[model samples]
Target: MCFGYWLETRGHQVTIATHENFASFVRQFDLKFAPIAGNMEEFLQSKQGQRLIAGEKLKKEEGDKLLLQQLESAWSACQGSEVIIYTPLATFGYHIAEKLGVSCFFASVLPLTPQGCLGF
Candidate 1:
């Protein structure tokens, strides 16, 4: 909704890739969507996903892999955009942009990750 509003106000064509639950909502804004496979319920069924979401355990290696997968998915969805404005909270987005050799500008609402954490 926020992305759609921003795109409308700025008069930009925005493509949003999300789960089916949001398809109808995004359609209301006439925004483009590349539907993502697997819902939150499916992810929660995974051992690693369950552990991460439940805060029951932490697996840096597995978490990193999942993050990379998500980034790749998002990058694929945003292909062909002239510029991608990635919100700072999306650490995976930043990495995927850099990896794809795309120009990106980041926005931040508050301090979350440490300055050096992004490897700037």
Candidate 2:
């Protein structure tokens, strides 16, 4: 959110695409909000979410389903975008940018592992 605000201050139009749960908070910064599908709060209270929080890897099918959902929603949110700034978790951003022939940047607050860096 701060990054979006900073970009706005620099005269750039910045919109944050995130879960609906964050819409209010994102709007507080006066940033345009493009809501991605999913109820993060409810998810966090589910068994799968609990497993994820416990560091358990998701089953392959479950992971794929989640990825597909994210890809679809994020693609819609990114329409007509000239540049895409995304987090590591949103790996679909790279593919979307490639298809759109636009610049894409990866931003993260966490340290990247050697394997993760290689993947990027």
On the 0 to 100 scale, the lDDT of residue 91 in model 2 is 75
Task: Single out the weakest 10-residue window by summed lDDT for candidate 1.
Answer: 111-120
Cα lDDT tens digits for candidate 2, 1-120? 666787788899988998889899999999999988787678778998899889999898866776677778999999999899988767788999999899999888465554442342
Best by lDDT: 2
TM, every model: 0.58, 0.78
User: What TM-score should be assigned to candidate 1?
Assistant: 0.58
Off by over 4 Å in 2: 63-65, 109-120
Show how many residue pairs clash in every candidate, following the order shown.
Answer: 0, 0
Tens digits of per-residue lDDT for model 1 on 14-110?
Answer: 7766655667877887777765444555667788667867877665775666556566667787777756666643555566667767877676646
lDDT of each: 0.65, 0.83
